[model samples]
Target chain A: MTENNYIYAPSEHPADKFRCKVPMKGTRQLFVIDGGVQGTAAPLSIKFDEGNCSDEILQVIGVRTSSGPKELSSESSFSFGQNSQGRLILCSHTFAEDPFITKEKIKISLAPNSSVDIVLMQNEHNDAEHISEFEIDIQRDASLRMVFLTLHGGKISNNIKVNLNGENASCDLNGLYIVDGKQQVRNLVSMNHKDPHCYSSQLFKGILDDASVASFSGLIHVWPDAQKTQAYQENHNLLLTKEAKVYSEPQLEIYADDVKCSHGATNGRLDENELFYLRSRGIPKKEAQLLQQQAFAYAVLDKISSEELKERMVSLTEQRLRGEFSKCKNCCKNCC
Target chain B: MLNIKDLHASIGEKEILKGINLQVKPGEIHAIMGPNGSGKSTLSSVLAGRDTYTVTSGEIEFEGKNILELSPEERSIAGIFLGFQYPIEIPGVTNVNFMRTAVNEHRKAKGLEPLNAAAFLKIMREKMEVVEMNPSFSSRGVNVGFSGGEKKRNEIFQMAMLEPKLAILDETDSGLDVDALRIVATGVNKLKRPDNATIVITHYQRLLDYIVPDIVHILYNGQIIKTAGKELALEVEKRGYDWLING
Candidate 1:
């Protein structure tokens, strides 16, 4: 697992060396199992079986970290059994200029007739960098919904690959990223349909301001044997300034007939008619923009099944969009 | 309580409204009817402070202030509302959430406390009946997937929610069916008070039968060519605007 996941070409990625280092200062580390202190060899490996799992278990997963900015390096693996139901939240954050370097790989396998919800909240400090890679597998009668939100980060990248290896498996991937200033974010998604009667969807949106840069590339593959497959992909981007930039690509390869598939991508400024409509209703220009953006982001945030998790994500997103996080003094270090 | 004097406006170097004059008082309903491209909608756009329409030379005073100097949102906060011809569709923004934000903003401008959730919801529910809107719309995105009539009715519903001092309904009857037209006109008429006024802009007299404007003006070639009473609308509808324009 270590060789297949952590081996990045050093010639091409010199920064990967700094990120792959262990027991290093000036870098916030991932919270590991049995204690997150530096040099701890603990990594969370959870396999949920059928049971009455409560929110307390999710709470123990440390959705709320201790006060002050922290960082880490982690390799976590999670799996579920038949009829298992629960939510798992992973947060990548930092409090200051100290880099928050995370090389995370989440490998999830769901048994038949089971489901799970995953929220990957990538919210690092202004000077932090985070890289997360996910390899997921779905079985027959299994479904998965995962939301990836990139709110505040200096340099962030999310690499996700999902394979529907069994019949009747489905996956829903939704993401929202709002970046400003000199920040940069990238998301690359790859999904493969290996069996018949499988489903997959992807929706990603980005709002860029100042000199920020964001990119989204999604690829869906339907093998010849994967008949009756349904796949959809869409990416939308909004640039708030002339200097902001975005690159979006939605690619699909189908070797099977009798399949339903569609893909679309859009990049532009805010809608003039919608802005005028909001302003005509008495909302100030600034407030009107925030409302529209919040509405734009709700498509991804509202997909979380847990009410508490959904509320928490909404507040976090609102704070980021309102520019509250940019205010260093009020930057509650304990904020998740 | 709304007045426009020698109002001349243009869009991108093209003059659409040329030296128009109008006066609307409290409790009065004034219908501005004209042929297509006769500047009926331009009047509403200029009054609403839409940035696209530049006020080349004119005066629009709302409640004693020169509204031409205010931004679109400032004019709205100052009790001026424009019912859109084509309502904007905002996906994922629930109607209740949008209205709550808009209402609170207006309240904030007037130095009044914002209504709590319960109070706001009650008001929304009560006003939804005015336009025959389903209660479920409060949770649906604003104007998303709505039919033509539903879009127009939603505009009137927003007017009912905001309770503006000067309401300008621009071509509100264009896409509406007879039943929807009655409901929308009823909502407009119900919102009228002795302290508020309304300006109905349309291309036909079908809506005037229900709203019953006190005065009718024929706007032709960017000017109000003739001004009269409700009987004038019947004459224009029966004889058509060619007579008015040719005269």
Candidate 2:
């Protein structure tokens, strides 16, 4: 058995690292874990048997660290006969000057029916790259939902690939990114439907200001046998400044004849009418803007299934928008 | 409670309120009636210290202080409230939260203690009754999804919550149905006190019928051309502004 499944460390390592010491016995036991101290690096790895544990136990994973950048990597093989569920959460972060430097990857080979919810929240400084890859093999009757919230980041790129290997599989990807002050973000998503009755949807929205830039590139491919496939993609951007830039490209390749697919992209500034409406209420221009922005970005944070993570993300978003880190005090309790 | 002497204000470089003069005593209502471009709304905006309007040469005194020198929020804290001709809609921020903030801001400036959650909610419930506003309305964002009349009522609701010394209702009667108009006027009348004053800026006399003002002033070509007792509002309503302006 792995002894490191539950361990706490101080903030001393230049880069904290942890590998699950649990042996690969593929037990059907439920595992509950908590986070460690703030300023320490921790690398986590989880493995499971493809066939036996898939039908019995539901695996849950949580990552809450104030450390520079916590790392999580998971690998699983194909398993049928049972259903499995997995969830991952990251919160309360003060990124390293170059946080998220460690490379991470999650590979899943589904059997027939399995599901996963992977949520990544970047609420610290807006200057780090979350370089990670997620590879999923969707068997028949399997599903996956990837919800990402990038409220603050200087530069980020998320590359996710999902392959529907069996019929009757589905995947949904929803993301909201708000960039300000010359920040740049790029999200690249690719999904392949290889069998019939496969479905996929993607929605990405962004708000850019102060010469910030954002890009969304989505690709959906339907194989010849993937009949009755439904695919949709949309990317919307709101540029707060003239210098801000946004680029969106949604590519769809379908060989199936009977399919429904659509993609749309919209990029613009906030509603002037809405601004005037807020200003008329005696709310100062800056406060009005902050209120509107909170509403705009909250649409994404509300989707976080974890209440704790959702609250942390909202707090981080408010701090980022208020430029709080620039005026960071030692005991920042008012950040709530 | 309020005084405007030879007020001259403009939007951009164009003059909107040109050389206007008016005065309001405590407990009295003054309604300014005019056509579309006669600066009916400009007077209210200028009095409330709206930034878009540049008061070129105007002296507005609220309780004997030069209010033109105050910022919008500062003016609000000084008991100056403008029931916007077109109230704003702020999403995600509950009406209760916004009103509580405004109330506490004013209270804090007046050297009074801030209201705790319990006291604040209690006051909000009472004010909601003044405008016949739904109890749930306070939980929704400010003015968001409110109907035309509901928006006007919400404006009055906010006024009741803030309890400002001088309230400027800028066309609060506009877009309001007869029932809404009566409710809003009742809300205004209920809040009236010998120490508080109201300036109802409207284009019609229908609102005046419900909340009779002490005086009715005709604003033409950016200035007050005529002023008379409450009966003058009906005169304008009967014969229109042409009879008063041309005569």
Q: In TM-score terms, which candidate is top?
A: 1
DockQ of candidate 2 is: 0.25
Docking quality band of candidate 1, CAPRI definitions? medium
Tens-digit lDDT string for candidate 1 (B90-195): 9978899899999999899889999999999999999999999999888999999999888888898899999998899999998889999998998898888998
Give model 1's DockQ, 2 decimals. Answer: 0.78
Candidate 2 residue-wise lDDT, A78-136, digit = tens = 22222656554432233244444323455655557766565665554554544546677
Candidate 1 chain A: minimum summed lDDT over ten consecutive residues — where? A16-25
Off by over 4 Å in 2: A1-86, A91-100, A107-116, A123-127, A136-145, A152-154, A162-172, A178-182, A191-211, A218-245, A248-286, A326-336
TM-score per candidate, chains pooled = 0.89, 0.78
Per-residue alpha-carbon lDDT of model 2 for B92-132, expressed as tens digits?
Answer: 66787676666766677778998999999998998899989
Candidate No. with top DockQ: 1
DockQ scores for all predicted structures: 0.78, 0.25
Error of 1 at A103 (Å): 1.8
